[model samples]
Target: MIKLGILFGGRSGEHEVSLVSATAMIHAADKTRYRIVPIGITKKGDWLLYDGPVEKIADGSWEAYALDCLQKDPARYSIAILGTGGRSLKDTADFIIPAVHGPYCEDGKLQGLLDMADIPYAGSGVTGSATAMDKIIAKAIFKDAGLPVGPYVPVMAEEFRRDYPAVKARIEAQLTYPVFVKPANMGSSVGISKVNDGSTLEAALEEAARHDRRIIVEQGIDGIEVETSVLGNYGDLQVSCVGQISYTADFYDYEAKYQNEDGLTLTIPADLPEEITAEMSRIAKEAFLALDCCGYARADFFLEKGTNKLYLNELNTLPGCTGVSMFPLLWKHSGLDFTQLVERIVELGYERYSITHRG
Candidate 1:
């Protein structure tokens, strides 16, 4: 049996969400096939083995039961992978499932550490994860691939603070109202705002800047928010059924996404013309390979209502996975349940690791 370390929770905005994903994953891994080691990361970012019964996954209840947390016994805890890496139980781990999302954990920071430790892990490598994390960079890559992408302007925090008016003016000139102001390095819509006018734009920019040094203001597309999940290593990949997200609000911000669902509706296997679905899957696969992403990625896009134009949004190397998240949901729609999905990812990670680390 493979000793699998399920890494979850971290110093990311989606930390609470990670807890939910991790809990679901732990419950799903086949006990007879794999021995599981549950590793949790505190909001402050400390990695440790949490000792507690799994209950209703809380968004933010136990930060890291420091005092009650399990003490690292060499025999039980295993070595720390010898370097900064996914602190998986090095005793064995044929594979590691990183149920972590957002910055510090998903942005290749943790992936790089894992790479150096010589441990196999699910999802993209350092470069791929970092590239996918920054919307500005990822969008640029998509555009260069000749994929139709919406126009976006990047505003550095330093630049935004130095001359707010000039930056705002440039944005106003290039994009119309109803643009999305977002932190370049965030996920789960934690620091995103849809601005309609200069007043909202200013607040949006300021709010976005608080999350990251770089901000991205993307031109809005009049379409439904549909997303597809891509899986594989480099050349060989598959795109799952497309799903449409309907937010109660004009946009699917954090509130509508996790907290409140007043205006949130999820349509699995989105009812689209066969051709459109084919096209979305094709473009999504191309984008995934274009970025050299391995294992899995959630390709988000905009399907403008009347015009029928599809604009590729950036790909998420490590997407949200809180059971209710789009990645697992889309795959579930594609016939891979949460358990199979986790197992598949771990297998993919091992397969990729064998080839790449085979030197």
Candidate 2:
């Protein structure tokens, strides 16, 4: 059986969400096919090898029993495996599936570490992860690739502080009210706000700046939020059926995404026209390749009601992987169930590693 290291929990605002995703993955992964080694990372950037109940890991209670899993003064990236008689043996993983989301974990930092260790892992590589995580860069790439994207203005924290009025004026000039203010390098809507007027512009920008140095103010689309799942290597990509997310909030913010979801509804194979669905599938793959993502990613879009115009939103390199997550659910509708979806991602990881790490 393959020794799979399930990496979870991270030093990000999305830490709790990561724990949930990790717990679900741990439960869904095929035990007979892969031996799981659960590794938990604390909010303070400490890595621990945890062997406790999945529930504890999901509730941030596993840190109490966390043990150092790294080799002693190791020149290379290696993990310590507990052996008989309480002895620890330095070993390397056959493969790793990082259920981490946002910042230090998903913004290419973890991928870089694994690359340095010569370890195979699921999801995008360093370049793809970094590029996709930064909204400004990712939007530029998408626009350059001829993909339709909404009007957006990138504002730096220093600039926002230096001249709030000018920055606000510049934003108002290009986009209308009800624009979305988001941290350029965050996921799970951690620092996103929907501004309906000038009164809330500064506060929204400030809220976004709290998460990252760069902030993105996207013109809000009066439409539905939909997502498509893409998987596999570049040339052999697979796109899942489209899914629509309906929430009763100012927008799909953190609370709507993870908590207080009484008004949340996800419609799989979104009741969209055949042509629109096909176009979204095509555009999803295009965005995936434009970012050079591998293994998997969920491409989100805004479909304007009445007009039927679809605008590409940012792509998520490490989208939530819970059983109810749109990524897996869409694939589940496309024929692969949750367990099969997890197994396929691992296989894709191995395939990507073999091709890229060939001597």
Candidate 3:
């Protein structure tokens, strides 16, 4: 059986979300085919080896248990074993699946560490993770690749701090009212706000700058939000059926996405014209390749209400695997169950590693 390390509980605003996602994946993974090693990273950035009830993981109690175990037997539970030079992460698990998101977890930092340790991990490499995590960079890449992206303005935290009026004027000059202010490198809507007019733009930008040095204010697309899943390596990719998110909140903010379960509804194989679905699938695959992404990713898009024009929103390299997440649901609709989906991701990771590390 393959020794699989499920890394979770990252040092990110999405830490709790990552815990939930890891729990879901741990339950769905086929135990017969893989020996699961639960690795938890505290918000303080401490890594521990956890071997307790999976329920404790989501409830945030696993950390205490892991700490207790470490205190009792430091050599056995210490994550130092994952360090370079001796008995590294490669010796602990044959493969790693980071069920984590946001900054340090999904923005290529963690992937870079694993790469240096020669550990094969699921999802995109460093470039794909970093690019996809930064909305500003990903938008530029998409636009350059001929993908339709909505109007937006990028703001540097320094610029906003130095000349607030200048930044606000620049943004207002480019985008109309009802724009979305978001941290360039955040996910799960952790630091995002929908501003209706200039009156609220300052507060929105302030909230965004609190999360990232780079901020993006995008012209809100008055349209339906749809997403599709892409899986496989560059030469061999598969796009799943499109799914739509219908939310009742001001927007799909953090609360709507994870807290208020009833605030949104997910429609799989979204009821759209055949041509539109095909076009979305085409664009999804294109965006995946444009980022040189491997393993699996979810491409989000906006279908304009009036023009019916589609705009590439962004791609999530390590999309949530929680029960309510659209990534797994879209693949489920495409005929791959949660277990099969996890197994396929492992296969892709190994596939990429073997191809790239060949002698």
Candidate 4:
């Protein structure tokens, strides 16, 4: 059996969410073909080898049973697990699935580490992860690729703090009311706010700045929010069915994503014209390649209500992996179940590893 490593619960605001996604993956992964090794990274950035019940991993009680498993020695390629006789060595995982989200892990930090060790991992690499994590950079890449994107203004934390009035004035002058203020590098809508007018703009910017040094304010589009999942290496890509999220919250926020179970509604194969769906698929693939993303990504789009104009929102290299999450649901409708999808992701990871490491 292939030794499959599942890395989750990273140093991110979405740590708890990562636990849930990793739990779902562990439960759904094929046992006959793979042996699962659960590695839990605590909020404090401690890496531990967990050999507890999968359920405990979700609730986070697994930390009590985890063995400190940091690789302090560069010569040791395999993980060092603590056993009764002291520390024992375990073979390097044949393939590692990084289920971590947000900053420390998703923003290329962890991917860079894995690359240094020459390890195979599922999902995007350093460049793709870094670019996709920053909204401003991704928007520039999308715009350069000739993809349609909404207008947005980026402000550095220092710039906003030094002269709040100037930055606020710039935002007000460039974008109209009802703009989205968000941290440039956060995901799962962790630090995002919808400002209706100038009165609440500064506070919204402050809230976003709390999470990231760089913030982006985008002109709100009156459109339907739709997402499509893309998979595979650069040349050969697979685009999944479009999924629409209907949420009652101000927008798709952190609470709507992980908490408040019924706060949002996700419809697979979103009710859109054949042409629109095709366009979303086309753009999704284009965005995936444009961002240099490999393995998998979920491309969100804003379909203008009246004009039917499609605007690229952002690309998430490591989207949520729960069975019911939009990414998996979109793929499920596209003919791959949860188990098969995970297997396919691991396969793609291997494929990417081969191509990238080829000497």
Question: All candidates' lDDT scores?
Answer: 0.83, 0.87, 0.92, 0.87
Which residue pairs in candidate 4 have backbone atoms (N, alpha carbon, C) closer than 3 angstroms, thus clashing?
none
Model 2: runs farther than 4 Å from truth?
A: 67-92
The true-versus-predicted C-alpha distance at residue 225 of model 3, in Å, is 0.5
Clashing pairs in 3: none
Per-residue alpha-carbon lDDT of candidate 1 for residues 1-359, written as tens digits (9 for 90 to 100):
88787888888788887888788788888888888866777777666655456653354444434334445453443336454345444544656788888898888988888777787899998888988899899889888999989989999989978999999999999999889999999998888998888888888888998889889999988899999999899888988999989876768888788777656789998988988889899999988877889999999999998988899988988887764689989999899987898888988999889888988
lDDT tens readout by residue for model 4, 26-139: 988999999998888888986777666899988888776664223343233234532222233225465789888999999999888888767789999999999999999999
Instruction: Give the alpha carbon lDDT tens digit for every residue of 1-359 in model 2.
Output: 88788899989999999999999898989999988888888899867777667888888888775643234323332334333222222144568899999999889999988877677899899989999999999999999999999999999999989999999999999999889999999999999998999999999999999999999999999999999999889889999999999999878888887886686899998999899999998998988999889999999999998899999998999999764578888988999988998899999998998988998
Per-candidate TM vs. native?
A: 0.93, 0.94, 0.98, 0.93
Candidate maximizing lDDT? 3
Q: Which stretches of candidate 4 lie over 4 Å from their true place?
A: 67-90
Highest-scoring model, TM-score: 3
Q: What is the alpha-carbon lDDT of model 3 when measured against the actual structure?
A: 0.92
lDDT tens per residue, model 3, 210-280: 89989999999999999998999986999999999998998888888888888889999899999999999
- Output the better candidate (2/4) by lDDT: 2
Q: Which sections of candidate 3 miss by over 4 Å?
A: 81-87
lDDT of 3 at 137: 93
